[model samples]
Each structure stands twice: as C-alpha cells, then as structure tokens.
Target: MHRPRFLSGAIAVAAASLLTSACTTGSGSSADGGGAGGAQGGATVRLALTSDVTTFDPIRQQAASDYVVGRLMYETLVGQDDGGAIVPRLAGTWEQTPIGVTFTLKKGVTCSDGKPLTASQVAASLTRYRTISAGAAMTFGPGNTGAGTTITGDDKAGTVSIELAAPWGELLPGLANSTTGVVCSPGLTAGDRLGTGAVAGAGTGPYELVGAERGSAYELKLRKGYDAWPQYAAMPAGRPAGTLRVSVVRNESTLANQLQTGAVDFGAFTGPDAARFGKGGFRVEAAPLIRNFVAFNQREGHPGADPKIRRAVAQAIDANAFNKVFGGTGQVMTSYVDAKAPCVSTDPSLLTKTDPAAAKETLEGVKIKLVGSNAVGQGAGNTYVQEALRAAGADVQLTNADNGTWATQVMGNQGDWDLTVFPMIYGQLARGGVHFIGDEPADGRNFGAVDNKAFLAGYGAATTTVDQKAKCAAWQKAQKALLQAGDVVPLATVNVHYVFREGVSATIPAGAFDPVTLRIAE
Candidate 1:
C-alpha cells in the first residue's frame, strides 16, 4: 500500500502559536555525559535530529521519520539503489509472466527474532496490509481502492507469486517503498501502532529496534545473522559500525551546537542554519527534491472553480520572488513532473510565468480570501500571492488560519478564503499526483477536491496501459488537464539539505525520500 505524507491542521495551529525557544542553552552532552548508547566496542554514533517524529510504524504513519526508522528495521522485497534503479533486497530475483510475477525468496534469511523468512511470511505480511482495518488500503487503481492483490506462495520452490487483477507496470518500483515492507506474521495480529506512537515489529534489516519514546528518541542495535547484511556493501565497513541513537532536537541552532560539541554527529540544516553551519565547520550536502506545488480547492462553487479567477491567481504571483524568500534552496518547477523524470515536458511555453496585468484583468472586481499557516516559511509565498491579486484589482484578504481548520474550510467551501498553500513531497513513481488529485472520496493529500472528468479518464488510461511511452503520455495529459483547469498552481521545488560533523558518513539512498543510514567513522 502506498502512503502519502501526513498533514494535521493541529500542526499548523501549533505552529501559529509557536514560540521560539532557546534550544542551545544547556550543555551539549546528555546528563549522563555520554550519548544514549554510551561508548561501545569502538565508537558510538549519536544523530541529533531537529523534528519530532510523529510515529514509528511504517504502515500507520507516512512521515519521513517513519521511513527513516523503517530503513533500519525492515527490508522491502525490492528497493531503490543509490542510482534510483529498482533493485532486489529480500527477494533475490523476480520475473513476470502472462499470469503473474514470481519473486524468489533469498535463502537462509531470518527476522530479528530468528524466525525464518519464507515465501509464506512475505505473503502473509502483504495480506495483512491489504486487509488493514484502520488505515487506508494501498490501491493500484482509481478511487484509491485495492485492486484485489492476491499473494500465493510455494514452499517447495521458495517463491511468492503476486497476482494482480491487471498488469501493473509500476508494481516493482512501488514495492520498493515502505508501504510494502515485510512484517512478521505474529506482528500482523498485534495491530498497527502507528497512531499510538510505538515501534514493534520483526523485520529483515541490518538494524533492530532497541527502544523508542514518542516525540523524543529511538534506539537501534545492529542485527546479528541478518541475511541482507551483504546489501550494505556500499556502506562503511559493509555494516553499521555500532549501535545508533537518533534524538529529537528540533531547534536548528541546538542541532548545530550539538554537532560542534560532539554531542551529536549528524543532522539536516538549511536556510539560516545551512549558512551558519557552513561558517562553523560542518559538512553540508544538497539534493533535488521532487516538485512542490500549491493546490487550489475546486469543489463545486469554490472560487477556484472559476477559470478566470484561477488563472488570475496563477498569473499574478512572481515565482522568482517566492524563490528569493525561500532562499534559493531549490529550483523552480514548471511542470507537475520532476525535471529528472522520464517523458517530462521541457518546453518553456508550457511553464507558468508572472503576468500582473493579465491577472488583474482576469480578476477585475473579484473579492477573495487567502488562508495560510503562520509558521515561519510556511506561508512566506502567500504574501506575494496576496499582493499580486490586489495588483490585479481583486480584493484579497490574508488570514492566519490554523492548518487543521484550513482543509475543512476549503473542503466545505465555508471560509471566505479562495486560496491556501500546501506542499507535497513528490515520489519517484510520480503516482502522488494521480492518487491525491485524481482519485475520489478525497484523500488527505488531495486537499483540492479536484474532480475533472477528463483528468480521471486520462489517469485511468495511464494506470491500465502497460507500455511505458504510452503511459507517460497519458500521465502528462492528465497533468495538463489539471493545469488548464487551474486546479493547482505549480510552485518551486524545495531543495533538501543535510549537515553533519566531519567524521560522520551516510549513504542517502534514492527512491525513498527519507534520509537514513548515517554511520560514524570506524
């Protein structure tokens, strides 16, 4: 099952009332004068993080934190290599026939608890996810409904057959994500602890969960006898050097201070923090993130439903100004698909450019309310948007609304607001756009409530078509429909930056946006 990023309105509300606290006041060391694991045989690696991870269960929470933890605890049947190719992990090899695809399970593998890993265990794990009662089931088709996936196993041949109702060309790449990680059979009956803030599972990875405290920290120990240990050939020493400790230290200054004082070995830094860290002797790395965009609410009668008003809003704001305030940290995206994506459109003619006069003419005499989060950088661009609309002769009011209430207001079309700002972390598969905007019964990610018939039909065609070139055309066409309808405004792609101490090293894998696998120099 695919999991989209989770956003809570309450989070926005909390951010609005957020007080900037002094995170670096105390000494860098813990009260014990050692990191969470204490000094091990060689050295200990303690990663001090800034954000509070919402949950540890991969199936329950789709947060980046969960993916970070999953990278240590579980191994998917297939995974994305550093080069972004779909590579084998737990399953040694796989092949597809007219009937279905068969995955050959790696021999002599076992979970953290020593339970033998088999075709049945893998099948059972998938079956449990398909039958999850609490969260939304992972779907491969329209309406976000499960496509009746059936996993059949052969103990004699040590293989698993995944039978889909129709041919799913993107199946392997999709399975490389945490949404399809193998779970222990016993853990399947225990219920998902995602919302409860607990981490309990027997997985097949190089590390085992030692403990986790909600909103605080999580500890992991190197797993012995792990069959997938060989997969870490690219990592330092081909294994985790020692036990790793990840702490939640949300303040960027505190994280930087800790890194300098040797209290923490690694963390992410951007914006002012990036500049500060670079001047303070820390190693910084930057990477291109999938495109980010602001969605428009297109539910019936919503202001965004008016083509003229939508076009006016889109044309008014200067993306260059938004990038300036955003700190030149990422590139500006013109299309829904990432620049690196196959079959992406590169024609400049299709891109959105600022046109204040055109925007004003389109929005002449229109009055609209703009709502956004008051958190730092959350709604920095909304100000520019408001200014542009006003320049176009539209009466625009800016309001600080709690993020929680923002979606409901948009969905219900109750608030006088005509626009709001939301950001998305696009995945490699490019399925997020289709799932959130094209699928119905409206998912949390699909805050716009866009219901374009042409887009839906195009999305259906893209998913059903097995040909790669044809599928890309269909997907691009679907995106065009949304853009032409003014259902969403393309925004700049935000760059993700990570900062760490000199001795710390990590292999940040591709495909999974989560940054995990940091190790201290041996």
Candidate 2:
C-alpha cells in the first residue's frame, strides 16, 4: 500500500536546521545531567535523571527531559520500530490522496481520564500544534508563503484529513514526530500544572502520570487498560504492574553511587562515565546516533567561503582523535548525514583523511574562528579541531557557548564564524535533510538562501518524484554532490549509551529514550 509522502524539499530542509536548535521552553528545568533509576521486576523502576521534566505539555516542551516523560504519558498518531519501519499507534491506517492525507484512528483507544479517543480530539491537537510550535509550522505549513494546511474531522468515521496549501511530500513521518502527540480538547489550552491535580494530562500512551515533585522526581503508572504494545494483549502477570520513579540525580558522583548500590536501574552515560560503566559491572547498551560535524560558512565574504579552504580544513581534522576524547565511545564519521540513513552519500571523499602537509600549504596565515554549539554536548570535540589546525600551520580560534546563547547568535549570523558544530536528526530518509545547506532556514537560516543546481535538482526529484525507487536514487546523488563540495565536514559517530544493572534492560530508540518500553529482566 502507498503510504503518506514526505514534505516538499523545502519542508524537510527547514526541519533539519532546527533539529539541534537550542530553543528553550522556559519551563525552568535543567536536562544536561546523568540519571539512575529502576527497581526489581513488576514493583517500581527507579531512574536517576539529571533533571526532571518541566512540563507535560507536548507541544510546548523543548527539552529532551520533557519528551522522556511526555512520551510515556501521551501517544502520537504512529511510531517507528527499532528498525525504522513505520507502525500504527493511535492511527490504525493512513492513505494519501490528491488533495491531502487521511487517517483512521484505531478502535477502542481511550485517554488516561477514561475518555474515548476521538477523531475530533486528534484533529484539533494537530492543528493546535501547527499553530503553536514554530518547528511544526515549518514542516507541515505552506511553502514559506504562510498558507498552511486545512484540517477537518469526521467523528462518525473516526478519521482526520489534512490538505496542505502547498506541495507537501511527507505527511506520516511529519505527524509521527514527538511534538505532535495527540490530546483531548481540554488539553489544548490547559496550563501544564502537572502533579498539582489541577489537570490530569490526557493521552493514549501506555503509562499515565500518577504524580510528580517539581525538580526532584516524577512517577508513572501503567494505564490499567493500555494495550498499545500488541504482544501484551493480556498484560503478563508482571507487566504493566509497576510504578516508575525517576529522580533528579544531577551530580555525577551521586549518580555513580546510586548505580553501584542498586538504588537506580538505568542511566545514560557519556565521556568518562560510559567507559567507567563498561567495567563497573553494568551492562552498557550503545546506540549509534548522528555524528557531530562542522558546517563551514560558505557565504560570500566569509574566509572559509573558498571551496579550497573548506577542503583543507576537512583534511586537517582527525576524526579518531575527537572520538578518543569521549572515552573511546564514538566512531569516526562516515558520511555527511548519519551512516544508517538512506540519503547519506557513499563518496570516499566524505571520510577526508587528516593531511597536515597539504593543509599547511593550502593555508598561508589564513585564520578562522570555530564556534561550538553546546546543544549536542560535544564541547571537547572543538578543542581537537584547534590542535589539528595549529599543527597544519593554520591560525585557528575557538568560541564556545551554551545552547541558548549559541542558538541566538551563531545559527543565522553570517561571517561570524568560519565553522560551527552541531548534530543531525535526519528525518524521512533525509530527503529534505541533505538540501539544508542553502540560504533558506538551512542557508544561514534566518534568511533566504539557495543551493547549487546539482544539489537542488537531486533534492527536487527525491521529494517530488512519485516513483519511490527513483526518489531514493535521486537523494543519493544529491547527497554525493553536497559532500563533494565540502561545505560541511562530519567528524565522528557518537553513541548515546544507557547503563543498566544486571536485572534491567532498556529498549531505547536511536535518537530518543523509551521509558515506556524499559523492562526489568525476568
């Protein structure tokens, strides 16, 4: 059966720019620390988090912390498995028509409050998110022209249909994003006062919010009747029979101590912690994520704008050296996008080898500034670049900022830095993802910019071409052309590692943590 298509090239490209965005939700919760929590089977799974979620409101949530909790409490229209295949959730099935896409809700789904999940509720939630979330607006919205989509609900038919004002290529993948979690009407304008009993956040997720203590901890209980995970038609005797207690174990020492004492069941580790956990008797589950890379500002007047200089820096930096600093947890990058992605280029030039001699000859007193965006937590990676550039006899300087500052200043500012570092969360096989380098939101983004013909041409076919096989081929060619241009240099593949004790196991996705599927080994 034909599935929903990806958005236009512009839609996917715009989405890529903000995937690592430092935008804040103002909920006042710190999410940058490690966590530990879980208990024995079917009792209570205790987790230590660096920070607890600030809000249960899905659309307004900006921190990864919020999604960890929100995802367990709410359900989206559809979801992807570990293999990246799209599966039905709240949406039983979907089909694309000339005007737009239509979705039929799964039968018998109900909210945590015991209200039936209605088509109108799902329809309103999608529209509300598009109106409130800037990121979602850019994805499903009209062509930068602001026309947007027309949405309608058929309660009797249990379906919702959406027609875009412009050419949209991917609808299912866009709606399946975490930001589009569906909720009842009352949830649309309700304040996110989670735990005060002021509002019981309603959704169709497996777990329900029992209560929470702001900044310290939160609790989740399996919904009595939630059967979303098909294997659990009749929940096993020990399944959906436990409470989840996630605490804010912010300090590294305390988190390590808790893991040793069995006070917590799981924790995500990086830097030294991951290496330490490897030998610390904990089972380390390493999931490959997109590599962090530097995008050289290729705009006119920028010192790195010259293609030759861009290639020079690409060959100077050592990808392995950057991974070594992360306690040997990362791998050298293989492509401009994540290696597992379909749209990634296979060109050998992508893995540019470090050549000090060549880089030195290419650079004659040419100095460039490298800006490190802390959103990806790869600050140490920037130092390696400075050392490599200096070794090649090129003058180099580094400026680092927390995500908030980096998001405000460097993301769109032209001629500010020769290089900037960030991660990629390529969606829809990176159809629009590979084309993000041009001026639009991807082009220095706050302005209108476009890419070369080869890149744009490939992206156009990949997104608009109806033949699926031909589309994939088009995306491959587009990515190759971009990598050959050397506008951006991918450094290394970073793994988001989760540490679990002997009795615990986790089912985390590539780019996200899945608290609901977290299980205690029998």
Candidate 3:
C-alpha cells in the first residue's frame, strides 16, 4: 500500500491556528557549560509517536510521523519560523537574484562522518532530490521540484545557487522542507540503504540516527561539533538533549499515561487525552494538524459526476456542526487550504450552505460510496458525514479503513468510491491547486477528476506573478471558483497539541519543533 496522503508535506506555518505560551521559550545552550548527552546532563528527553515512521529518507517521507523525527536527523537549506518566514539552516545567509536565489554555506558545518560540508556537495544532493521526486503526488513543499531548474556550486566561494524553471514566488519556502536535506557522500553512495536506515553518516543535521528497533523505538545522538542552528530572532536559551529517544506507541491512552508517570518527556496528542496535559503544568503547543474536507470522484458513471448531486452533497454538510463533533477543538475551514495559508477565502457566501430541503429533493435515492481514513479522529468525522448524507435521502456506503489502505483505494484506479472525507496537511497554497487541477491519482494528485475552467484560469493567473499582492488576489479568485462549483468542500481544521514535561521546553513554529531550541530547566 502507498503511504497515507495526509500530511504528505508536513511543514507547518504559524498562524492564528497555532496556540502556545511563547514562540521561543527555552534556556541553556551547549556553550552554557551544561555539557551534552543525557548521561552528562540528566536523562534523555523521551518522545512518543502514534505510528512508526514510513522511511528514514527525508526525501521519501510522506507522513507527519516521519517529519517529527526526520527534521532532527536531516538539515534543510532553509526552514520556516512560526510566522511562516523563511530562515536559514545549512546556508548561513542568502540573497535573491533575478532568476532564483544564492546561498552561502556556514563555515563550520560538518556531516555525520566528520567531513566538512561543501557547496558542491549540497548542489549534487539537491540535483539528486529533484531527479527522484518527479511526477510524484507531493514535492514535500510548494513550487516544482526543479523539473527544469539549474543548480551550480562553487566550493571555493562557499556558495550554491538555484535557478528555477520559472519565477515562482514560494521557491524559498519550498526549500525549507526537510525533503531538501543535504545528503553527504556516504549517504549519497549508500543508495537504497540510506533510505532504509541501513547506512549512516549521510546526513548533515544536529543529530544522527544511532539505533532502531523497527516499530518499537529509534535513537539519535547529537553531533559534537555541529554549529548550523538557524539564527532565529529570539529563542529559549538551551541546547537540544545529547540523546533523543523516540518511542512508537500505537495506543493513545497508554501514551498519555506514560506522560503522567514521567516516562516520556514529550508527545503530541489530538484526541481528548490532550486535556490531561493542559492542567498538569506541562508546556503545551497547539497547531492545526489537517484540514478536514470532502471531495467527489467527478469521473463519469459516479454520482458525483452530476453537478446537481455534487451541489446537494456540499449543501448538506454543516461546517459548524462538524466542528462540534471534534469537541469544538477545531476551527471551521473556509477554503480547501486552511486559514494558515496565505490568501485563503474568509467569505462564507462563496461556499454552499446547509439546505436540507433542496438536498433532499436532489439526493433522494442516490447511491454514494463514502470513503475515509481512520487516522486521527477522521472516523468520527466521517460518521457525521454519512449521517448527514443519509438524512438527505442518499444511500451512503461508508468505508473507513486504515490510513495506508484508504489512500491506496482512493488514489488508485479502482474507482471504488464516489465521495470521500479527505484530511490534508498543506505546505504551500500552490500545492492545493495541484489537488483540483492535475492528472488523476496513481499518476497525479487530483483524485476527484475536477474540471473547473474558472479555477484553472484563476490558478494560472496566480502562478504568473511573483508579487505577493497580485498572487494572493489571484488565489482568492481560484479558491472562490472551486467552492462555488463544489469541487471540494472544506469542513474543519483539527489541532494537534504538543505537550512537554514541566522542566522541558522547545521553540515550536507551525506546529513543528525546532531542535536547536530544546532546553531542560536545571
């Protein structure tokens, strides 16, 4: 089965969706004489994961679970702060040129193998990533994955330059994705082994993977001389733990209990268990996990192929009522992309409203196959969807499967479903355009077979400009077109809460934690 499509490009942007005590809250750096390693300091910071990572390769990571661990072991050229601003990572500084951007590598950067990192190596790694990521459903971030882009490096000048195929305004933000992590010579040569965790020394991040027990646990050790932390304007004053241990526990209750017992230092929770951490003096961070929505398989022979049926289905969904199903922990979404995305539609008039009378007249006796993923609280949400549709006189068949199987069936050529509740995590606004106007799934991301000419025109106009104002204006038009045609119906944005033990802290931006800002209070 293919990896689940949810959280395909898991980099998050800080917005109204993010709820935390502070953007940068930590204390103590390596230079503070605290020394390194859990043994030297106190005890290792333990993390809990709801699922095991799909792959160790940053380039192939498809789920949020992978990103949580992958970010520490792999370094990107740039990274996004809580406010979605681009920040330097491996590149100490950068400047935009006419065609693209140029970056200067930090002076003391080194790979896990203790070899110095060079601009030439970074260029080669980027080229490899572009070649491997072609025609894939997601590129981890926005902008084309260097399909026709040119990259060059000068080791003597300590510079790497990227010239895109076009004037894509979000190129820098796209580079912030962990998928662009530079692979060193050892990892580049390890081939498939590198992707499978069978090789080491291929990464240039702060931590290196040292041990793994498949579904049980994974261990990472901080590099001794690592000095490539991003220059955040403000942050807590401590360094990451010398040792980072990620434990995979499938049960949410078990994971929550462990946090209370002080067995785990950190864990992200989406369900009701999150409330337990709120009152315990644990540091908490909350951000939108995914935008829950529904889409029609507009291919011929499907009920959704008819415009009237599609409209009726859209009219039957009550976004506010759906939000309550998740215990009111989520925000109602106004567009295909979440509110965190730039230029999202804030006008409710553009969307279809709940009209039970009209929906009943149009959808009576209509047969519908409703598919959904069981991950996170999607099953309950899907149930809400099924009951609403049934009330409108549609014969709905609901199939809520495991995340992986659900993705394979929905995106495959099986034609097994008519409508689906899809929960998506977006990296850039342009990525959402791919879902509504692209080749069908198994080959492309548009599983719904959407064919809205207005949406296409608006999206095309947005891509032609690099100006933020013009681009966002065009995007507003594009999203309005999609909503009016009922191509995709957005429901709610779910929040994932990150809880840390009383004395532990880290800077979280866009919901993802910054490794360098981790601190344990003495």
lDDT of 2 by residue, 1-522 (tens): 434221101212222211110011112111111111122225566655555565677776655556666667778887654434456667767776433678887777788777788888888888777777766744473352244677788999999888777655555556666768787766665655432322554666766676778787667666655544422111112222256666665565566565667666566654355566766567776655546776766567766678788788888887778777665666666565555554455566545567878988887588888777554554677777777888888888887766556654455463367777655445344433533534544333522132556776776666554455776789777767666777567777667666766655545443445555555443
Better of 1 and 3 by lDDT: 3
Candidate order by TM-score, highest to lowest?
Answer: 3, 2, 1
What's the lDDT of the predicted structure labeled candidate 2? Answer: 0.59
lDDT of each: 0.57, 0.59, 0.71
lDDT of 3 by residue, 132-233 (tens): 854221332234454657778899999998876655566666777777778887887887887778356688887788899888878777777677776554
TM-score of each: 0.81, 0.83, 0.86
Q: Which candidate leads the pack in TM-score?
A: 3
For candidate 2, the TM-score is 0.83
Off by over 4 Å in 3: 1-43, 63-65, 97-99, 134-147, 196-201, 232-234
lDDT ranking of the models:
3, 2, 1
Clashing residue pairs in candidate 1 are 9-403, 9-404, 50-249, 50-250, 360-392
